[model samples]
Target: MQIPLSQPDITQKEIDAVTEVMTSGTLSIGSRILEFEQKVAAICQRRYAVGVSSGTAGLHAAMVAAGIGPGDEVITTPFSFVASANCILYVGAKPVFVDINTKTLNIDTTLVEAAITPRTKAIVAVEAFGHPGGMVEIEQIARRNELILIEDCCEGFGGFAGDRPIGSFGRAGVFGFYPNKQITTGEGGMIVTDDDRFADVCRALRNQGREGMAWLAHQRLGYNYRLSEIQAAIGSVQCDRLEEILENRRRVAQMYMTRLLDNRFLILPTITDDVHMSWFVFVVRLNDLFGPTERDEIIKGLRASGVGSNNYFPPIHLQPYIAGPYGFKEGDFPRCEFVAGRTLALPFYGKMTELQVDHVVAVLNEQLEKVQMVRKPRI
Candidate 1:
């Protein structure tokens, strides 16, 4: 009865693809990797895509390619995974974090322009929990300011904002393919962009800074961030099935929404009009009346009842590594702190059944009732 939080949807097609790669003599820097890149680029409607070891590596390469280096400032959201901000630090720059919108759980566009300064080199906009809310406006702001916009689409693979795809909006977008994502490659990422020069730089950076296919000619200092041919083979198959996977995830999200819509103690995710959501994880927030302690107790109760759940994200700015260096304290970004404290990521995946979804909802409500009882004033 124990339901895990997330699972990748792997079919026999992926198995065959990987097995074929195993038979092939060339395991790395092979045709499969090139095919994977082309598939990702076509999906994003971008001119180029570079497969990398991970999303973090792609982000680092993107910043470096953009010439964002020492003494520069990159505006980003504090509510995202730490890597969103850490990437800026990787390129020897500072991350100027703005608060997020409580509804979309993405960066607040209204606050973005004010955060920009002469030192600002880029804006790293993350589609938190796979929600793309202010991306278009953020892109506009970046263009107006002549700054680079790096869309961190790590949680948003098959998502779309209006007619444009998630990775097609920014100067360069990065997508992660961890086991829990919409599509997975075991461990890999893709860097999507229309700029050929940026694509070339990323390709070189991911392969030990080589200028071309030649392995020995080192052009610049770079890390070993190349995605393996075996991983690419799996990713290519996953790309082919992206639409089906996205539809299944959307159905699961709808199921959760239908059950939790009327619950007074919970707040569901926000989906804007004209945006096609790619549900990465089904995260719901406990209402303001309940705080973090109560939320944690509810999660504990669910786990005790053989249900799996987790806090999807802790505020990036509040992490010890950033807090000490950036002088960030409590109340710096109240909305982000507020949302982060109460988020509970329930079991979610493309293959999840209605029975399992119902069981999770039942468990969640039972635990919530217990917390409510304890909080009641015993007059």
Candidate 2:
């Protein structure tokens, strides 16, 4: 009866892969990591992939490699996870927030070029909730503006925009392997690119800047962002089964759509016709009539019924730390804030059952009715 928000689909194959790595005793900077990287690069249709400790680490590395230093501005959406913008700050660059398209829930492409100043160095584009809308157009914008495009594909894997894979659209793209993701590597991530120099720079950065020039020689400041061999082993197995994993997730998403698509109180995610979603988390938004307070009550009610749920993201611009420093306030990006306020991420995993899906939808409907009753106008 306790339905958790997300579960990693780990099979015996993944367990065995990890066991093999443990038995080998080469836990760091070993063959497994290389194999994992190669598999990811292949899947993403990129020439290089550098494994890192986490997606945040990958993003920071990409920003550093792109030479995004102090006073440089990186345009990005306020709708994404904070790491997308925080990566800009990590490299001493300022994040320029753009409002999201209400339909796509991604940065509004039409406004991107207008946001570009001479100081703008890059665009950190995110594939929100595994939907790949406007990514191609964003890449085109970056190219015309001579800006580095860093695709934060952490929430999107095995998805495509037009004919190109999600990670292949940018100069460099990052993917996360958190337990709740499409695949799990315990805690790992990757930076993928076609540029050899950028790949080498990231490899050096991930390993304390030891560019194989000397084992102990430090060429520049770096971090211990390397992924462990054990994590890579699990990741490699997950990659081996990537297609199957994607299919299962797609099925789970379909089940949710079938049950909730017609509900007037909810606004389900909008995926473009050309893109095949890889369903990171099944998030549904309460209609505009219902604000955050009512959304919160439904979440509370869901939790009481043992059905897990959460707000997928709060507006990154509105986070006190970001807002206080950047002078951001309400109405700066109303679309992102509106969606952020009402989004509810439901229990989602590759192996989620139809019965579980039905139960969740039923509980959600009941909660919505209760809220509507309480907020009804005096008659």
Clashes of 2: 0
Cα lDDT tens digits, model 2, 7-68, are 99999999898789889979998999999999999998999999999999999999999889
Candidate 1 — worst ten consecutive residues by lDDT sum? Answer: 370-379
lDDT of 1 by residue, 1-379 (tens): 8898888899999999989999989899899999999999999899999999999888988998889999999999998888899999888899999999888899999999889888998999999988889999999999999999999999999889898898998789999999999999999999999999999999888988898767699999887999999999999999999999999999999999999999999999888787789899999999988999999999899999888899978999999999998899999999999999999999999899999999999999999999999988742
Which TM-score value belongs to model 1? Answer: 0.98
Candidate 1: list runs displaced more than 4 Å: none
Model 2, stretches more than 4 Å misplaced? none
lDDT of each: 0.92, 0.92
C-alpha RMSD values across all candidates = 1.0, 1.0
